[model samples]
Target: MGAPRRATLRFTSIAIGVALAIVASPAAAFCRSTTCTGDCPRDADGCKTTGKQLFWPGVCVGVSLQRDGSVNIPIADVRSVVATSFATWSALDCGGAAATISFSQLADVSCHQTEFNTSAPNANIILFQDTQWHYKGVDNTLAKTTVTFDAKTGEILDADIELNHAYNELTVSDTTVVVDLQSVLTHEIGHFIGLDHSPDPDATMFAGYDDGSTNLRTLEADDIAAACAVYPPTRSGKCEPAPRNGLGDACGASAPTTSGGETSGCAIAAAPSNTANRLLSLLGLGLALRVRRRDRFRS
Candidate 1:
């Protein structure tokens, strides 16, 4: 029998990516929301854990990229952002025999939607949505990641990410009021790679987000530990850094920018919230601003 499915979490610019355990829940709990549920996989001894560490077949993974970018930025820069964001985790020095993370581009896809198909070659895709933004509650969300895992063993089957471009102007420029596309993707990639939220507010996996911050673009200490714990260097497997099809970053016949050819732009959009400082102090607001785990899926 096929494994059951769990709920998913979506991403946003202002507030994005609350950590989750991919727990089996009723249909009512499956509806994504903006409130933190404080749910995570835990040991019977009470230690926190992810729903499960991802088990990559033969320790290799292939990802598909949408060949297009939102009107706010060029396609080249979008691919660069993805590469940079992914490299942060791939190049980590996990002491020794670590489960090194690596990525290679699949054929660039024309379809920017997020889904998995059993009848066809399913893709682990990351794409941008520039025309329409849809989700429950507020429309300020920046992106969302859908992770499909085995309901029985909690083993991840496939994952996809979608970026919201219609309401927000995204950019790769380091100096700009607009949101940093790389920063947002870095966080979602955490979810994409099977990480849940961290209790440390300063950690990148924390549910709270600080706009205009660049620290998240790189993996923090906590982020590294979570990955290392799952794919430790001593784990039993060979690490291969090549893609299934080829050793290039071309989406289909269209090639993407080289690692050095990163693009840049300004997404002059939302103003920093006046109360951003208060929200940053998640515990200061008492019950109103509780540091709860927010659900980001829609019914």
Candidate 2:
């Protein structure tokens, strides 16, 4: 690809909705990544059948937390959870294995929407939908991660997270019945960074999540290995932990109580593309494919 040109592209992982508490419902499904594949090693304990999708090796990925928080938890606490989730993914050293990419926490943004803008600056945001979770009909989703990438080589250009706060209750406490915000963030961050669900029941990337389980808050062997494969410890990228759009970590504003509105004036969510879908099918992950867009990449 030549000098990157702004293109309308999109990828999505459904987190569903906000719940009052995590009840013992049916087993929750796992995550998916369009960039990852099944050419995986079998020796890792938790890595059983999970494939790998990684960001380009030489860029310091910047993540930003929106100033929105669930009614049940403080926004600052939510930002802390986002930071720790990034840390867990970046700190993987499973013995000698290393992750190629690293993350820097950018400043907080006023926009609580997930969007990639070519005309204006945008932050890779993690926003809480306090009043409404908007998707077709899947209301049970807890959160969703959207990534825009170069479809040709799977080079990630931008990514964002949206937490469903309108339909359910979410918190950062250890109440055991409530959805662990930290645990869900950790899992969603996996998708933000390019990971699909693992076949291993013990893996954090496993598509299956149980209510009140904290295991997903940390990395499993498979999760570590997958991170290592995408970003080795030896790769090169500056450690820039500053917000790209000049927003700061100030929690004075309450996320709007309305059901729907624009978070940023510059971004529009791109729809899925058929070409990307065919490519995912060729990769043996058509069943697990959650995102597809052709303009997101250049051959």
Supply every candidate's count of residue pairs whose N, Cα or C atoms clash at under 3 angstroms: 18, 20
- Give the per-residue lDDT digits (tens) of candidate 2, residues 179-207: 66777778777777766655434556654
Cα error, residue 254 of model 2, in Å, equals 26
C-alpha positional error of residue 140 in candidate 2 after TM-score superposition, expressed in Å: 1.2
- lDDT value for candidate 2? 0.52
CA-lDDT, candidates in order: 0.50, 0.52
* Strongest candidate by lDDT: 2
Candidate 1 local lDDT, 38-119, one digit each (tens): 3433432122344334444435456777777667788788888888888776746776555555566666766566544432
Identify the runs in model 2 with alpha carbons over 4 angstroms from their true place.
1-32, 35-54, 57-59, 240-299
Can you tell me which runs of candidate 1 are displaced by over 4 Å?
Answer: 1-58, 238-272, 277-299
